[model samples]
Target: MPEWWTYRLEDFLLFSPRVYWRMFELHNAAVWPLQIPALALGAIILVWIVRPRQWPDLGSDRLVSIILAAAWVWVAWSFLWNRYATINWAATYVAPAFVLQALLLLWIGSLRGRLHFAADRTVRGVVGLALFLYSLVLHPLVAPLVAPLAGRPIQAAEVFGIAPDPTAIATLGLLSIGAGGAIAWLLLAIPLAWCVVSWATLHAMGASESWIPLTAAGLAVLSRLWPRIGSGALR
Candidate 1:
């Protein structure tokens, strides 16, 4: 048997590069124009995090949490297991992780009232806000930019709730904005893993966006740690 260490990255790629791109093309068509409302809601979520008092009702943020959780489940079933898994076997395992994350979000935010977002102007909070903006507006543009650079036609832009890329990015921001704890870490595991997996996939595809997922993971960590450090709290 071949030694695992002798395996190259390409060996693990089960699909042709063209097939991978085609998947996104078909996905874009399947979810055409849902991107608009998804992007709009993402932006509103960012604004709400920045000025949470605007809602002024206790547990009102629960609505946003519910929305985010629903998105997680949506991607798990709709994109990962239903679509992407057909081409990449690994995504089948990843799909259940996304489902677990969704349940975590719902359990913590909706049932337990443990997950909440607010603006504190602390180092962490500011970083969280920045991540939120990145996921909402800037994340979609990433695909288009990488397309020409990779000598491909413009790629279908993905948005939060409607697709995995933005959903992963937005989840990073949410984890950062909420109180970081064991439960937060639990919620964070799958997204962080997805980012790493995505990094490898993009790298294999010769897309410049290859590295951005890892970068988002790093930023999410920093956003989580910065405030805790400043307050001399690390748990």
Candidate 2:
């Protein structure tokens, strides 16, 4: 047998790229028209994000949190627990984390009423908007566009509120816009971690879009940190 160090990342993968992409195809087919309402919900979230609002309002913030929490719960139950676990046993473990995130969002935003999101013209806001649009719109198109080129199924595109990666990405984008304080940092943890996990999985599968998650994570972190860095530089 070859040495452990000699083994490629792909060597450890239990499922091939075809199997991985096909899972999405099956998932999409099974879920059917739910994608329509999911996309509509995403559009509503985008409107909420861009709408003019004073910071820390109770009603809007709580509603947004509830919406996000629902998305997390849906992705956890529908995709990770139900579908992904069949192909990757590790998904069973990951589904709990998604549930935990949903709980956190609920406890912090709905119960305690802490999360506040608003549209700002700052660098972070732009990054947040870009990330949100990418996750909601562009990310779904990725699989369909690449399918023709890569010979993958066209119906395997992942959508926001449905797929874990896009759900996490959209969460990060929403958080970046105006969320602050320790609670914001606490909320950021799981989504950022999931992005890394996603990047690793796709990288192992030799998927060309593996870097997308890592890039999103890095930009989210940097956008969050930039204000601090700017303050320190000025001081």
Candidate 3:
């Protein structure tokens, strides 16, 4: 037997790249039509962040939390537990974390009313909006556009709320908006961890897009920490 150190990441992979992507395709097919309302919910979240006046009460921090909590729960059950676990057994473990994150969002943002968001033209805000939009609109197009080049089906595309990557990315973007207090850090923890996990998994699969989640995670950390470092909060 080869030494442990000689083993590459791909050596530990239980599924092929085709199997990985096909899981998404099958998942999308099984959950047909739900994607439409999921995208609509994402648009509503965007509108609340961009034009708060339109929603007023619904735009409040609590409502955003409830919406995000619902998204997490949906992704946990529909995608991670139901679909992903069929391909990767580890997804069964990951689903609980997603559910825990949903609970945290509810307890902190909804019940305690600790989270907040507002529109701004600052560098952080711009980055946040860009990341959010990328996750919502651009991320779905990524697999569809690239998969065909790789001889994979375009139907493997991952949508915002239905998939874990986009959901985690969008959550980090929204949290970077104006979320404060230590609760913000608590909220950021799971998504950031999932981003790293995603990057590792994709990298193991030899996917060129492995950097997507890692980049999002890096930018999120920098966006949240830069302001503090600039203000001497770190010192």
Rank order by lDDT, top first? 2, 3, 1
Off by more than 4 A, model 3: 1-6, 53-59, 231-235
RMSD (CA, Å), candidate 1 to true, equals 3.0
Off by over 4 Å in 1: 53-58, 151-155, 227-235
Clashes of each: 0, 0, 0
Q: How close is candidate 1 to the true structure, as a TM-score?
A: 0.89
TM per model?
A: 0.89, 0.91, 0.91
Residue 83 in candidate 2 has what lDDT?
Answer: 95
Q: After superposition, how far is residue 180 of candidate 1 from its true place, in Å?
A: 2.3
Candidate 3's TM-score: 0.91
Residue 108 displacement in candidate 2 (angstroms) = 1.2
lDDT for model 3, please.
Answer: 0.85
Give the number of the best model, judged by TM-score.
3
Q: Write the per-residue lDDT of candidate 2 for residues 1-235, one digit (tens) a residue.
A: 7588898767767888888888888998999888999999888878887883445555666777888899999999999999999988989999999999999999988888777666677767888888999999999988978876777655888899889999999999988875777787899999999999899889998789999999999999998898887731222
- Residue range 49-131, candidate 3, lDDT tens digits: 88764254444667878888999999999999988888789999999999999999999888877777665776567778888
